[model samples]
Target: MQRDKFLKEIENLNHPNETLVPTHCSYCAMQCGMNLRVNTSTNKIIGVEPRYDWPVTLGKMCPKGVTAYQQTNHEDRLLKPLIRDDASLKGTKEGFREATWDEAYDLIVKRFKELQQNYGKDSLSVYGGVSMTNEKCYLTGKFARVALQTRYIDYNGRFCMASAAGGINRSLGVDRGSTLPWTDIHETDCLFLAGSNTAECHPTSMFRIWAVQERGGYLIIADPRETPIARRADVHLDLRPGTDLALANGILHLLIENGHVDEEFVKNHTNGFEETKQVVKEFTPEYTSQITGVAPEKIIRAAELYGKAPNAIVLFARGIEQQVKGVDNVSAYINMALVTGNIGRPKAGVGTITGQGNGQGGREHGQKADALPGYRKIANPQHVKEIAEVWGIKPEEMPEAGVSAYEMFGLMEQKTIRSLYLLCSNPVVSAPNSNYVRKMLKQLDFMVCVDFFLSESAEYADVVLPTTTWAEDEGTTTNVEGRVIKINRAQKPLGESKPDWQIQVELAERLGRGKYFSHLKTSKDIFDELRRASKGGNADYYGVTWEKIEKQNGVFWPCKSEDDPGTPHMFLDKKFYHPDGKAKIFALPYTPPAEEPDEEYPLRLTTGRVVYHYLSGNQTRRIQFLKDMSPEPFVEVHPDTAQKYNISHEEKVRLFTRRGEVIYKVKITEAIRKDTVFVPYHWDFERAANILTNPALDPISRMPEFKACAAEIEKIEVKKVQ
Candidate 1:
């Protein structure tokens, strides 16, 4: 009774609290639903926690979600529009001059029109940043199609999920919507995670995998390094980098030899089974083991576990797709799922995990090189007609297929792409081959960047338009699981910064394209238009509207009608989008890395993310706390290699590749493989990993091999201070 009275008295204490509003995570594509508890009295977000009712996130969010509010308050945020006053020269006295929104929009319109008149529309390229909301993405696509009449439009997904989209599009008829019921992770008896480190990257989603493993279910982890997930896995296969296709094919071979395949499922639900089987027969365990570096017996055991398990989920990430053989690797994994009857059902399918925050949502709304809204292929006559009618333009006017991201940069170097309008992306630090990207930027006649910060790439911009961050804006985003969520405005725009859509719309109107850039008052108007475009398409998101979403936490796509419940998982039935209602299977083969270590560079360098920082350190690096924890970039070398080279921990080391060299501190550890060294690529100055990265790209996807690059490392002796 005394304890109860004390608790009641504590609860009754008069303390002001903020009004909590519902929102979505802005960090990654997971788009975890969250609640922003704002201090109404102070006009600041005091706390952020997950929304319990959302089925996808399930009240789980990563650290990035909880701390996203910091981005709004970060000192480095650009609060006003900046225009370059001096000439466009690198390291020049050309600093940014603050401009009003009207001035910025007017100048942008004048330049775009001048460029169009001077050069063909094909000469202008528009690159969308995936972090923008679906509403913003819709407006961007509209601007490219209706205003500029430029078919040379694409998003950053070409760098992140191109192979996943391309390979899946060829086989399953739809590029990027999840075929793997993601929520089915709870029901999965065995989870095979390849190339992804869930614990560090997708922390909240890993709960499902952890639950399965904790219940005596098996978890197979395949990666070059012994990541946190790999250490906790039931079976860890440290396969060689860029050899994922070999292992996937070997697994299929084992399943075929052991007769573990479901013939009935294959015959009823799939096509190309006979040819797939014949192809797998040649990829014997012995043959693949030699290439993938996995023992034949171990491959058989891994296959048996996956094939025999009642429910199995195979998840892949950029580690498999950011390679010259990325398309092949994705095909090999998808083929395994089809052969073993692991798809089109709950808890069993091929899952392609995206890297960027809004990669899925961005692509879903016509942000790809060869795709329009709703995952519709530009080559398809029907798809082209549908989009053409919606945009009030002739289908024939659209470019057959614009250049991919890698090709776009290559064209910039060759002087084919003279002008570029970059929205929300920092290509200087994020794109592979950092030095090459920097040099190409210098070659461009005009480059415009719209972002919240003066990022690494913004340094070369002829014009920089300050844009609002997530906290200062209102929009919607989609998660990795195809779940759509909203981003609520918790505060006003920082100084002169405006929402991305507003800036683009304002510019479009100024350029006399007001008809296409109409309905710019609110995000709701833009979202309603997106819904109209999605009607009857592969990803029908008609069920959701601004009114409906505001009343609830969120809704997933394929909500085609008013009474329809948003789709939880796609492709639950055996029916596919193909003509015959069957998914095609492609046989993928392993291809070596673009650059291989030789006598001059006798080591392999692998680049990846750090726990504290995100890609290129655009936002996270600005945080003093995060920066303090990870002050400088460092190279992780194995103990044996470090000892052989007489390198000590914290000692400066020079790493050299064919392209360039960088110096970083040595971090000797057993976690890294013997001949391989691990380096975080987020740093800008001391050791930019992209400087030494391979620029070779996948044939089908056009994504460069940012993960695997050949290099050599040596200890650099410091001279004694005078």
Candidate 2:
């Protein structure tokens, strides 16, 4: 019987030599290189492997990349367009009535025209998201600015990486796609990992950090919580949240006072040295240590490690830029890098680790409110004229820069924004202050959402356009190191779903703005134009053609010609693009957090991601394997604090803030600080963390304070309802 069963199993096997297709991960933007293999006969993806030959992890990937196959052909994916016949029905649909692609596009065109004709074009707002491909991002910007002529346009980047974009542009005259590549960090002798947890967020890259440690390289981490990476660091400076500016300025003070300053490098490579030095003198270690809650000795040590190291790489993330004073924090770090003569050299960099999969690409391609492709400010007359001339339109025809995400959501509630178009994002669950964002979406006259699944945001849409997932799409994405990787589709659409760029093109043509999309009949056409537009910019890809990039796996920007190998590290010669031909070191002061512990809310609250779940739980939670790894939400509280509150591990507790409260299971551990609690912002059950997140946005970048807030905890009675 066993031999007969084995023979039957062998007979069932077919097409064993299926070829694999090359592609990029569609999850978060680390863009870990990958390949997906499909059975030739069944056309079914059978396995996945890392792009080991490629740079940046040498093709290694985290758990997210290994399990990306689960997303393709998943049963929960949206295969058809869904229209809400009744707003009050929720998912209780009156009917799902499948329609042709033309029907869906025509319906959207009709509704959009009605909105424009009834309300002014400015009354309609389009929200681009980070999950989109480069082709979709470019087309979305073109459609909104040309076809719709809407002044209200922004994306979820405001919630995460807007400040990084603003600060980088202000300092370097352009936005993302780093001049520096990932290999630069490996060349450094010292790694100043501040306000970031790469061990947890980007585990594959952590191996590189381990390699750095093996080489006797120093590691210094600055964060409020002693994260896993921090515990392993040579020195961990637990600075108060939102006080990074003070810590950075104090380090600058120590470097100058100890004569560790690279005078030759500074004089030859930087500007504003005298004024910046004078301003930083006041931020002495003793003075800033008090405000930042770090010891003076530790502050001095951090400065020594950074200043004395032959090469130091300064890195930050949402923890630093997702605060009310985010821009100031970034400005201070930039000054520190420039003063130490740390930037523009191999392994000596000051850069932000972007959060979303395409946050870097999205901002670079002009999805930002104030930007056009290539980081050209929309408000700049010369830039506007240049883009307009390229698009064959009048410069004055373009609308002024508009409100950001927070302001746009507020306007929706105020009826100022009548129509809302959200692309590939779930703002209902992802936005800070969930209740208010949900209510505002409900109040909007019409809401249109484009996504691969029926997410929280799609639930409220009047019309939901099913979008193609990464396995069923084609385009390009820039990784954290600014390497542009291609994403070739491996599967066809499930039903009538289409790629986002195609939808945008069809809609534009239907709106009688076919001329706007006339130059681009395909995504490759747009990619070529993007290279042309970005010719002289910071992320120059003009030299990288399709044939060369595919053959090479990927290439970093500044590959201006087909014959040129892409640049891996930026600013190696200290040649800055500033008018003075030198990087400017700004003098900035630190401020307190937007929210803090008070009488009512007597503890500090911080939010972050977990190993198993991605932001908003849009896709990760749906995976049965991943869900089993971390099935429910929980709050990490120190045992001492939990005992004082009479809370126990696995016991239910209610976490409250001024805005809202959520009940979650408790995990009492000594790994956390005494007065602070850590909650992963993954679950969206009754206790979504974003529900209690403060909406205090940065005045300059308009990014919400997602890192730190004030809150209280209480034991909740787990009552069972019959």
Q: What C-alpha lDDT do the candidate models reach, one value each?
A: 0.78, 0.79
- The alpha-carbon lDDT assigned to residue 268 of candidate 1 equals 86
Clashing pairs in 1: 28-357, 29-357, 540-558, 543-559
TM-score of 2: 0.94
RMSD versus native structure for model 2: 3.1
Off by over 4 Å in 2: 1-17, 90-97, 177-179, 717-722
Which tens-of-lDDT digit does each residue in 1-722 have in candidate 1? 74786575455334366566777777767777777766677776655657887666689976566667778767887887777876545523267788877777677777777787787776678888788889888788777767777777887778888888777777777765466546778688888888887777777787788888777788988888889888888777777777788888888888888887888988887888777677777778788878777777777778888989987888888888888888888878888788888887877877787677778778877877787877777889999898888776788866666878767888887766777888878777778878888888877777788888888778788788888888778877777866677788987787778898887777777777787667668888888878878888877777887666666555667789877767666578787778898888775545678777688788888888876777778888777567777777889998999999998998989997888899988988887788789888888843688888888888888888987878898678778999
The 10-residue segment of model 1 with minimum total lDDT is 9-18
Which number leads on lDDT? Answer: 2
Q: What is the TM-score of each candidate against the true structure?
A: 0.94, 0.94
Cα lDDT tens digits for candidate 2, 1-722: 74786575445444465767878777777788777876667766666768776677777787767788778778888778777767775422343455566777777788878888887888888998877777778778877888888988888888878888777766655555355777767667888887887877777778778777888898999887888899889889887666788888898898889887789978887767788788888988889988888899899888888888988888888878888888878777777777777777777877888778888877776778888877777878988887787777899998889889888998887777888888977777778888888888878887788887777777777788888788887888877877777888787766777888878877888889988786687778888888776666555777877777788777777678879888777766666767777776776756788898898888888888877777888889888778888887789898899988988888988898988999888988776677788788877635588898899988989999988899899887667998
